[model samples]
Target: MEYRKFGDTIVLRLEVGEEIAESLAALCEKEKLELCQVSGLGAAGQITVGVFDTEKKEYFSREYQGDFEIGSLTGNITRKEGKPYLHLHLVFGNPRQNVCVAGHLNRAVISATAELFVRVLPGSVGRRMDDEVGLNLFQFSQDS
Candidate 1:
């Protein structure tokens, strides 16, 4: 993976065999990004996404194998409990005509390339597990 830092933004270029989330996480840590917004478009061979089942208090994950177009990857990233916490949603356009799926991003291996737009912010958002919802949600912090 190669990235160019431009002021408060970083343009990430994912190479062959790079997983989107993993690479992004590494970039965030290396760059020391405390708060940021991430968006991108890419193609993937295999991917897993989540569906939070409130009643079950669990995340129901679905995996897809085979090529698909990454429709809209958008999320906010923040340091939570000293770790980079990324919450993103994805919409995939299946290679087969007339098929599409959307869910919370889990894991995706790049097929050819991915272009990411990341804007680094100066702030912090604390996250804690919400037992009833069974998710780590942000509690916005003003201190940078």
Candidate 2:
């Protein structure tokens, strides 16, 4: 993985065999990114995605193997327990099936290359586990 920072924005390049989510987490830690928005596209394989069942408060994930084109990768970075936390969604296009599968990004291995852009925000937002929602939701500050 390679990255360059420009102003408050960062451009990340993921090489073949690299895992997308893992690489981003590493970058977030190394750069100490508190809050940021991310978007990207590329080719990937061995991907797993999940959908949350609100009623059950659980996630159902499915793994896909083979080639896929990353149509979209978007989400945000926040802090959970004072550590960098990532929440991302992905859209994978399978040419062989002529269909696209999308969900909360679980994991993906880069088959070719991926280009991601991260726009860092000034303020930090933390996350708290919402018992009612069963998700780590943003925790905002109340100004005095």
Candidate 3:
């Protein structure tokens, strides 16, 4: 992975064999990023995505292997327990099958390369587990 910072934004190049989510989380930790928005595109050989089952409070995930074009990647970075946390979604286009798959991104391994941008926000946001929602919801204030 290689990156350059411009103002509050970071531009990244993820090389082949790199995992999208893992790379981003590591970058966040190294940069000490508290809050940021992420966007990217690339080619992947393996990817896993999931759909959240709100009723069951669970996630259903499926993995795909073979060449796939990353149509879109979007997500956010925040702090959970003072550590970097990432929440991402991915859209994959399988040209061979002429179909697209999209959902909450679990993992993706770059087959070629990926270009990503991170825009750092001014303030920090924290996440806390919400029992009712069965997920971590953002906590805007310390008291909340």
lDDT of 3 by residue, 68-126 (tens): 99999999999988988899999999888999999999999999999999999999999
Candidate 1: list runs displaced more than 4 Å.
141-144
Best candidate, TM-score: 3
Least accurate 10 contiguous residues by lDDT in model 3: 135-144
TM-score of 2: 0.95
Candidate 2, residue 140: lDDT: 92
Error of 1 at 135 (Å): 1.3
Highest lDDT among the candidates is held by which one? Answer: 3
Clashing pairs in 1: none
Question: In angstroms, how far off is 75's CA in candidate 3?
Answer: 0.8
> Tens-digit lDDT track for model 2 on 119-140?
9999899898899999988999
Candidate 1, 1-144: lDDT as tens digits = 998989989999898789988998898788888888999998988889998888888889999988789988999898777888889888888767779899999998999888899998877786877776788878765541
lDDT of each: 0.86, 0.93, 0.94
The number of residue pairs in model 2 that clash at the backbone is: 0
